[model samples]
Target chain A: MFIQLVVSGLLLGCIYSLISMGLSLIWGVMGIVNFAHGAFVMLAMYAAYYGDQLLRIDPLLFTPVAILLLFFLGVLVYQIIIQYVVDGPYVSRLLATFGLGFFLINMAQFLWSPNFRTIKESMVHGVWKIGSVMIELPKLASSLGSILVAALVFLFIRKTRTGQAIQAISADKMGAALMGINLKRIAAFSFGLGIACAGAAGSLLATFYYIFPDVASLFGLIALVAVALGGFGSVEGAFLGALILGLVETLGGYYVDPNWKYALMFLIYLGIVLIRPQGLLGRGKV
Target chain B: MMELVRHRRFPTFILLFGLFIALVFPWVVRDRFAQNTAIFVLMYGLMAQAWNIMGGYTGLISVGQVAYFGIGAYTSAFLYTHFGINPWIALLIGGLITALFGVIAGYPVSKLRGRYFSIATIAMAEVMRISFSNWEYVGAARGIQLPIEKESLLTFQFHSSRLPYYYIILFLFIVVNLVVYVLERSRTGFYFRAIRDNEEAAAGLGINRSFYKLLSIGISAFFTALAGSFLTQFSLYVEPDYVFASSISITVAMVAVLGGIGSLGGPILGALVLIPLSEYTRAWLGKQGQGLDLMLYGALIIVFCILEPKGLMGLWKRISTKKRTSP
Candidate 1:
């Protein structure tokens, strides 16, 4: 039972890591917490659901399509709204994205009717039992896919030139500009890429989780906590932080009470943040 | 003479005029919808004013103020339901308890800076919400519902009319505003601004940073709890979700921000504008469950944030300055 719980927790954590990594990327590069991130995730879920229902496309195949769609949406959001407030005070940035989030959520409700949806005939289904442990196929597939995507993202940031350019910009904006990097272009790309990660995760989530306009609030908030837990702006930290949250949530739910899992996560987050405001692997003053 | 009249006498005249209008508003309006809107304005205005002290003046940027609000609601509900205590007294105890919780929460939380502080506040509220949802003592997710009593000042319920509720909230709003008005010019107020503007500089000048922050949050919590207690008595219900939801905190923050954070009359102005608009929109267009009102509200917030970060007060300042410099 413990092993099954651990395995499921790990699987859940991997998906959470995927979600937080997107948030972390945006925060690391732009110093803005995108409040609309969850809204963006909601969009991806709908996209996957509709793509399956309308076009007969499987969610697995639609993952890349969702990513592409969100990438453009991210870039458009930057050009239209975020860029204007990028240089403003923290309050303005926070309110701008918060408002965007509010707008997106309500607009979604208006258009989509606030109904809970699911991909009924997805490619992944059933369960596999491995030596007294049962693992759901969809969960296993999504986790593996998340791991692969995370690895790709890690490599993209570390090895590629554009990725290194993103690094330079995050490290020192003026320095990166002086180094002849196109600051505007890179920033927009980074924003798009960050949201694209949400797209991937959202599609994966739609397979097993119920989809609704407000579902963004659930995953979005949890992702925010995971990012903070790992230390803001640190991709690796967010990954680990999400894993810890997943394990704690599952184990806490099993051991204590399922209702108390979210509370436990929040308490752990508060304790860690109070003791080390910079997070588990973050640096400098909070 | 003209400058003095414009700067000082005009404001005093406006104040007296506004006061007279407010005093006679319920009697003159006589519409239940309008009265409800007025009550909401006053209630939100008071709560936002409380938020302004910690978030606007002190620059703590908490998004979990609903924690204090929920605490106040539950405290008053518990006292009234279980002990058969007068709600007026319960209001006081709720305020005191919520203030204590604020200080306790602030001790560790106030150490963090900027976004970290904001997220921690969120976590703090989330913990409260989740815990309250599961704890059977407080009725768990079902929440505690206040039994309806005879309408009176002591009971804090106004069954016959919404007038008493309006007057009570109005008085609370005025008192809170006056407190903020005095706090704005006081020595502690200066410390709050200094810490907000530059904590390092404030510390350099020998100011105890965390103490003032804690004080601000404590005072803010007290007043916020009063509003919460008022809500319980007014609505005759206390639920974990409604009271502890992050939306309450956001709305309160929006009120302060929209009206002009750190300003005396800003929250009142924000509430005056926002509450009526929201109520009217919800009444008119929200019947179909389409969130048109919220969508517009969100768009307005984005536009305001992008175009005028300092909010309506900033716009007022710009207009006044432009007029002064035009000649």
Candidate 2:
């Protein structure tokens, strides 16, 4: 039971880490916390849902399409709305995104109402027995897939030229611009990339969790906690932090009352914030 | 004489005029729905004023005033239900308890700056909500119903009449504004202003950042709790969802922001504009479909943030500047 639970949590953590990486990247590079992040994820989830349920496309196959669509949306938003306020106070940026978040959420509510919907994908529901322990095969596979994708992203950022430019911008935008990097292109791409990652994570989540208008708020809060715990900008930190949170949540739910699970997560977040402030494995200033 | 009337007497006259309007509002309307709406507006105005002290004046931007509100609501409701305490007396006890919790939450989270502090408040509110939802004594998610009794000033019970509640909330609103006015003129308000402008510089100047932050939190929490207690009496029911909703916190913050944060009159302006506008939108569109008000509300916030970051006060400033130059 312990092994199974741990394994499940580890997989869940990978999903969190994947979703949070984009947020961390955007925050780290752009110095803008995208309050619309969860909204983006929600939009992507709906896109994936439509693809699978209406178009009869496999969720895995629809991931790339959703990613592309969300990337364009990100690009449009950055160019049209975000760029104008890039020079404003942090609160302005916060409000702009917060407004966007509200708009997206209410738009979803207006369109879909408060009804909960899910795409029934049989691929993620299969179970496999390993020794005496039975594990959900689809969840395990999805977890591994997410981990693989995260690794690929990490490697791409490390090796690719555009990735190097992104890193340079992340380090210092003006410095990168002086070094002949196109700041605007890089920023637009980075926002798009962030949304793309959220798109992938949304599909993965839709496989397990039910989709609703307010689902993003819960995931967004979790992502914020994960990002905060993982050190605002570090990919590896997000991975570790998500894993830790997942384990804590799973164990707390299993042992303590399930209702107290959120309380436990919040307590852990508060404790870390009080003690570390920077997070474990985080080298950057919070 | 004209200049004096414009500058000095105008403000006093406006204050008196506003008070008169508030006093006669219930009598003028006489309709239950409009009176009820006025009571709600006053209640929101009080809540928004309390939120402004923390978010606008202090620049703390707490998204969890709902926690204090919830605590106050539950405290009074619980006392009245279990111990049969007078609702008026229970309001005081509720405010005190909620103020204590505010201190506890404020101390640790106030150490964090900017987004982290806001997120911490959000987390705290969520925790409170979940805790209230699960706890059985206060009726859990099903909510607690106030015992209906004969209309009494002490009991805070009214028999299908909003007149008493309107006056009560309006009184609270006036008291809150007076407190804000007093605070704004005090040294503590200056300290908060300094802290909001620059914490490091304030600390460098030998100011205790934590102490002032906690002080702001306490003041804000006290009024917020008071508003919450009043709400329990006005609504005649208490629930986690109703009191502790994140939207309540957001709306309060929005009012402060829209009216021009860090200003004495901003929340009142915000309440005056947003509450009535939102109510009208809901009344008009809610019959057609749900969420139309929210959609418009979200759009307005976006437009306001993008175009008028300084809020309506900024617009006022611009018009005044133009008038000055036109001569």
Candidate 3:
């Protein structure tokens, strides 16, 4: 039973890591915390669901398509809404993204009727059992998929010229501009990539979890906490934070009254915020 | 702080005019709906102002205020049923208790800067929501329902007209604004703004960061809790979801922002515009269109952020100055 819990918990952590990676990446690159991060998650879920039911495209097949669409959406949002307000008040970016999230949630409710949609069966269906332990195949696949993508993203940001340019801008905006990096182009691309990361996670999770307009808020809160835990803009830190948080929540829920698991996670979060506002592995001047 | 309206002579006249309107409103407006709307305006206005103290002045945009709101309401409900305390008196107790909670939350939360603080606030609210929903002692997810008793001032109950509730809330609204007015002029208010503008510079100047931040959150929590307590009494019920929802916190912040953050009359103007718009839209489209009101709010917040992030006060200043120069 314990092994099962640990395995499932780790899988849960993998998904959270992917989601937090997107949010943290955007903030790290552009200094804009996209409050609409969750909305994109919800959008991906809906797209995957519709793709399966209407077009008979399996989520595994639809993931790339949804990701591409979300990327365009991200770039579009940047051009139309975010570009105008990036240099405005501190609250402007927050409010703009918040408004976009709010609009998307409401739009989902209006169009989908606030109904919870579940994909009963998918390409990655059924479970694999070894002796007394049973592992769900879809969950395992999702975890593996997320880990693979996260690894690729890590490599992309570390090993590529574009990634170095993105890092240059994040390190010093004016210095990067002086070094001949296109700040706007890099920022927009990074935003798109960040959104695509979230959409990918959502597409994977939709294969197993219930889909609703409010689902993103739940995952979004967790992602935000993970981001904070790992340091605001530290993608790797967020990933580690998400993993630790997932384990604590799952193991703690099994041991300590189950219902109080979230409270326990929050207590730990508060402790972290109080003790090290810079996060566990982050080196920022908070 | 610079005195409401464009000139120095307007404050007293505006005060008198506002007072006269409030005094004569009940008599002139016999419709219950109108009175109810006015009461909401005052209540929400008070909440927005409370939020402004920390968010606008101190520059702490906490997205977790609804937790304190829920706690205040639940405290009153628990005390009333278990200890036989009047809900009226429970309001003060609830506010005090919630303020204590604010001190606890503010300590760690104040350590965070910028977006980290906001995320922490949201996390704190989620924790509160989950805890309340699962705790059976407070009736859990079913919530607490205060049975309507005999009409009496002691119980904060009156059935003849909406006048009693209106006046009580109105009184609180005025008191809160007066407190803010005083705070804005005091040394503490100066520190709050200084910390907001530059934390290290303020610290170098000897303004205590965590202390003033706590003070702001404490005052903000007190009024928010008081409002929540009154809401429980007025509605005869207390529910975790209703009081602890994120939307309430966001709405309170949005109201302050729309009116003009850190300004004296900002919340009042914001509540006046938003509450009515919300009430009318919800009344019309909540049932027919489903989530249309929320969509409107979302679009408006975005537009306001892009066009006039400083809110109505900013718009007013531009127009007034433009007229002065053009003429």
Candidate 4:
């Protein structure tokens, strides 16, 4: 029983890590804590669900297309909404993203209605048993996908020139500008990449979890906590944070009441805020 | 003399006139729909005022005031149902309990700066909500239903009549506004603004940044919880979802932002504009289930913040300033 829970928890953590990476990237590169991240994730889930149900397209096959769509969305959001508020007051920036989120949520409701949807048929199906513990196949594949993508992202950041440039910009915006880095391009790219990751996570989760307009609220919030837990802007920290949180949530649910699990997670977050405001692995930003 | 009369005396006159309208509302408006709408407006107004203190003045931008709100709701419901306590007294205890939670929550959360602080607030509210939904003793996913035998002042039961709720909430609204009005000019308010503008500088000036922030947070939580308590009485049912939902927090925050975050009368203006408009829109378009109003308001926030971040009061000031400057 414990082994099964641990495996499930780890799988849950894998999805969380992928989802949170996008948000952390946005924050790290652009100093923006995007409130609409959950909403954007909601959009991606719909895309996958429709891709499957409406077009008879396998969600696994349509992942790249969805990711590309989300990338453009991120860029568009940056160009139209985010740019206007980049230099504005704190409240304006917050309202802008929150407004976008609210708009998207309502727009989805206006169009699709508030019904729970799932990708009924997928390329990945069923579960694999390892002795006494049972592991769901789709979740296992999804976690493997998460690991591969997370590794790719890590390598891209550490190895590539564009990635290095992004790091430079995150470290010092003025210095990067002085080095002739185009701020707009980098900002747009970072935003695009961040949202693309959100798309990817949505595609993976749609195979298993129920999708709805408000579905992003739960995962998005959890991703946010992961970002804070690992410290903002640290991908590896986010990974670790997500795993710990997922594990804690599952174990805590079993040990203490299931209802109090999330509350306990939040109290842990508060504890972190009090004890290590800088985060376990974060920099000076917090 | 003309300027003083227009600026100062006009406001006082408007306040007196508005008070008169509030007192005469139940009698003047015989329509049940309008009465319920007015009560909702006043309740949201009180909530906006509560949010304004920590958010507007202290620049905390909390999105978790719902934690206190839910706590207040549950406290009052539990006290009245289980312990057989009067809701009037429960009202006070509810506020106190919520405020106490605020202080405990704020101590560390206040240490966080910018988006982190705001995010923490969201996390706290989410945690509370999830916990509320899971706990069996507190009704779990199924909420608590208030069992009132008959219409009584002791239990705060107002079945079939909206007048009692209207008056109670009106009094609560006035008190909250009065508190904010005084707080805006107080030394603590000064510290709050100083911390908002610059924490390091505020600390340099010997202001206890976290202390003052917690004070405002506590006060804000106290009154916001009062509004929640009133909601429990007026609705006569308490649920985790209704009370602890993030949308409730967003609505209250938007009200303060729309009215003019730092201004004294901003919350009242926000509530007056938002609730009536929302009611009218609900009547015209459809139910909130359609989410049309949300889209409209969401777009409004985006456009308004882009164009006039200072909100309605700020816009009014700008127009008046331009008029005064023109010739």
Candidate 5:
């Protein structure tokens, strides 16, 4: 039972890691928490859902389309809203993303009608059992997809020119600018890339999870927690944080009461933050 | 001396006039809907004022103040319903308890800076919500419904008319504003602003950062709790979801931001504008639950943040200064 719980928890953590990777990148580079990140995921899910409904395309196949669409949307949002408040006070920056989140959720509600939709006949369905442990196919697919996408993003940040520029900006904004990097363009690109990850995760989630306007609230919040726990800007830390969150929530919920899972996650976060304000794998001062 | 006396007398006259209008507002208006809106504005305004102390002045932008408000409501309601304590007494006790809680919570929370601090407050509020929702002792998610009591000042209920509720909340609104007004110029106020503007500088000047932060949160919690208690007595119900919902915290912050943070009159102006706009929008466009009102609300916040970060007060200041200079 413990093995099964741990396995399932790890699988769930993959999707969480994918979501928070985007958040971590945005936070790391831009110094703004994209509160609308969950909304971006929600939008991607809707994109995948509509793609399947209208063209009879599988969500798996529609993933690239969702990613590109969300990439543009993310860039557009950055150019229009975030760019203005990037240098503003904490209140303005916080409210900008918060309002963006609210606006997107309500816009989704207005457009899609506040009803839950699921991809009933996804390309992946059914469960696999090995040695008395059951793994749902869609969840497994999501985990693999999440890891692949996360790896791609990780490589992009490590190897590519733009990715290195993003890293440079995050490391030291003024120094990066002195090195002839276009800070604005790089910031916008990073925001788009971060959101593109959400698009990928959302498409994967549509295969298993219900797609709704407010669905982002839960995932966005958890992703935020993951980002914070992993330390503000450390992608690897957020990944580990996501995995730990999944384990703690699943194992804690199973052993204790399921109702206390969220509370427990928050309590642990508070505990960790008090002791290590910079997060488990994060660098720099709080 | 003559100029100073005139300057002081002018504000006193305005104060007296404003008091007279507020005292007779419900009676003169004779519109239940308008009275109800007025009551909500005052209640929310009071809460926003409380938020301004910790958020605006102290630079701790907490998106989780609803936790204290919920605690206050739950504490008062629990005491009144279970122990048969008079609500007035329960209100005071609740405020005191929430103040203590604020100080305690502030200990660990005050250590966090900027976004981390805000996120921690959110996590703390979420913990409160989940705990209250799961606690069977307090009826869990079903919430506690207060018994309808005699309509009296002592009971804090008004069955005959909304007039009494209006007056009570109005008094609270005034008292809270008065407290903020005093705090704005007090030594503690300077300490709060000093910390907000530059924490290291304030700390260098022998100011204890965490202590002032705790003091700010405690005072904010006390007044916020008072508002919460009054809300329970007014509505005769206490639900964890309604009181502890994150939207309440957001709305309180929005009110402060919209009116102008770190100003005595900002919340009052914000409440006056926002409550009416929201209520009217909800009434008009919220029939099918299409969320137009919420969408507008969100857009307004975004637009205001981007265009005018200081809000209406900033706009007012700009226009006034421009006019003064031009003339």
Candidate 6:
């Protein structure tokens, strides 16, 4: 039972890790918290729902479309609003992103009316029984998919010239600029990539969980905790943090009342923030 | 004599004007809805003042003020419902308790600076909400209904009239403003401002960063709790949703920011502008459709943050500067 639970937890963690990597990257490189990160994910989930249920486009096939659409949105947001006040007080960025988040969430509510919409997929419902234990196929597939994407992102960041530029900027923006990298293009690309990751995470989420306007708040909070736990700028830390959170949540729910699961995550977050403020993999100024 | 008048007369005039407005506001409104709004403006003004102390003066942008507010509401409601204590006295106790919690929260979080502190406070608020939702004694998700009795100033109760509540909130607002005024001129406020400007430098100067920050948090929590208690009495109900809502924290911060943040009159101006505008917008748009008010509110915040980082006061300053330079 514990092994199955851990397996399921690890799978869910991978999705969380993917979602949070974009957020951490944006924060690390651009110094933009992107409070609207979860909102973008929520919007993509809605798009995926419509695509699968109404347009009959499978979520897997529609992921690219969502990524492209969200990338443009992210770029527009950065160029128009974020860039203007990127050098202002910390609170300005927070408020701008918060305002954007609020606007998007309200827009989603206006369009969707708080209804939990799910995409119907027979493959998701399939379960594999392995000697008195049950494994969810959709969960397994999404986990594997997230891991593969994460690996790709890792390679891209490590090997590609653009990815190296992103790393350079994250490490030191002024230094990178001095090194002849165009700050504007790098920032814009990083923002777009962050949104693209959120887009993919949204499609993965639609496979199991229902999509609603408020769903972003939950996932956003979890991703934040994961990002903090993993280490702010480390992609590997994000994955590890997500896994820890997933296990804690699943185990807490199994042992305690399920209603208190969220509280448990918060408690753990408080503990870590108080005791280990830097997080497991976090470095530099938090 | 003329110079003496210039120094003293302005403050005296402003104080008298404030008093006059407070006394006549209920009568001026006449309608219950408008009176309710007046009461809200005053209550929000107090809450904003509290938020300004921490976020504005101390430079801690807390997003968990709702936790202290929740404590105040829950404490007063619990005391009134269970022990039949007068809410006026219960509110005092609630403020004290919440202040203690504020110290606790401030202790750990004061170590963090900038965005981390804000995020942690938000998480703390969430945790408080979830815990309150599960703790059934205080009515949990269902909310607690205060036993409605005959109107009494001591009980902080009213049957249908908003007059009594208006006076109480106005009194609280005045007291809070006065406190802020006094504190801002004091050594402690100087220390807070110094720490806000530069923490390491303040520490180098032998200023106790943690002590001052915690002090600001405690005082801020006290007033926030008092506002929460006032809300419980005015509404005659206490619920986790209303008290612990993230929107409450946002509203308080919004008021502080939309005004001049660190300025004395910032929160007051913020409340004066935002509360009525939001109320009017909601009333206007509620008849037409859903979510329009929220969309407008969000847009306004974004525009203000982007265009006028220092808020309406900043815009005012800019206009005045432009006018001065035009000639």
Best-performing candidate as measured by TM-score: 1
> Could you tell me the TM-score of chain A in candidate 6?
0.96
Looking at model 6, the pairs that clash are A231-A282
Candidate 5 residue-wise lDDT, B203-273, digit = tens: 99999988999999999999899988988988888887888987788888888988888887678778989
What overall lDDT goes with each candidate model? 0.87, 0.80, 0.85, 0.84, 0.88, 0.83
List model 1 lDDT by residue over B252-326, tens digit each: 888888888877767877888877887888788787678787887788888878887777777776676677768
Q: How accurately is candidate 5 docked according to DockQ?
A: 0.71
- Chain B TM-scores, listed for every candidate in order, come to 0.94, 0.93, 0.94, 0.93, 0.94, 0.93
* Reference-based lDDT, residue B239, model 2: 86
Ranking by DockQ: 1, 5, 3, 6, 4, 2
Pitting candidate 1 against candidate 6, the one with the higher DockQ is 1
Off by over 4 Å in 2: A282-286, B1-16, B325-327
Weakest 10 consecutive residues, lDDT, candidate 5 chain A? Answer: A87-96
Which sections of candidate 3 miss by over 4 Å? Answer: A131-133, A159-161, B1-12, B324-327
Q: Model 4 over residues B135-171: C-alpha lDDT tens digits?
A: 7898987778888658877768878788988998999
Supply DockQ values for each candidate.
Answer: 0.77, 0.56, 0.69, 0.62, 0.71, 0.63
Q: Give one digit per residue, the lDDT tens place, for model 3 in B1-327.
A: 443334312245666688789888988999888889888888889899999999989999877779888998899988998888978788899999999999887888888888888888888888889889999999999889887888877888888878999999999899888888899889999999999999999999998898999999999999999989988888888888898888888778777888888877788778988788777777777886767778877887788788888877677666656766675
Clash pairs for candidate 1: none
Lowest lDDT sum, 10 consecutive residues, model 1 chain B, at: B4-13
Expressed as tens digits, the lDDT of each residue in B221-310 for candidate 6 is: 999999999988878888787789887887788888887787677888889888988888878875555577777777777887888777
Q: For model 5, what is the alpha-carbon lDDT of residue B161? A: 93
TM-score, cand. 2 vs. native: 0.94
Candidate 5: tens digits of C-alpha lDDT, residues A1-286: 8988898889989999999999999988889988788889999999999999999899888888888998998899999999999987788788789889898899899889889999987888898999988888888988999999999999999999998999999999999999999999999999999999999999989998899998987788888888889898788899999998988888989998899998998899889989999889878888
Rank by lDDT, highest first: 5, 1, 3, 4, 6, 2
lDDT of 2 by residue, A200-234 (tens): 88876766678888887777777778887777778
Model 1 residue A73 CA deviation (Å) reads: 1.1
Backbone clash total, candidate 1: 0
| Model 4 DockQ, alpha carbons vs. true complex | 0.62
Per residue, candidate 2 scores C-alpha lDDT tens digits across B140-184 of: 998789978889887798887778888888988999889888888
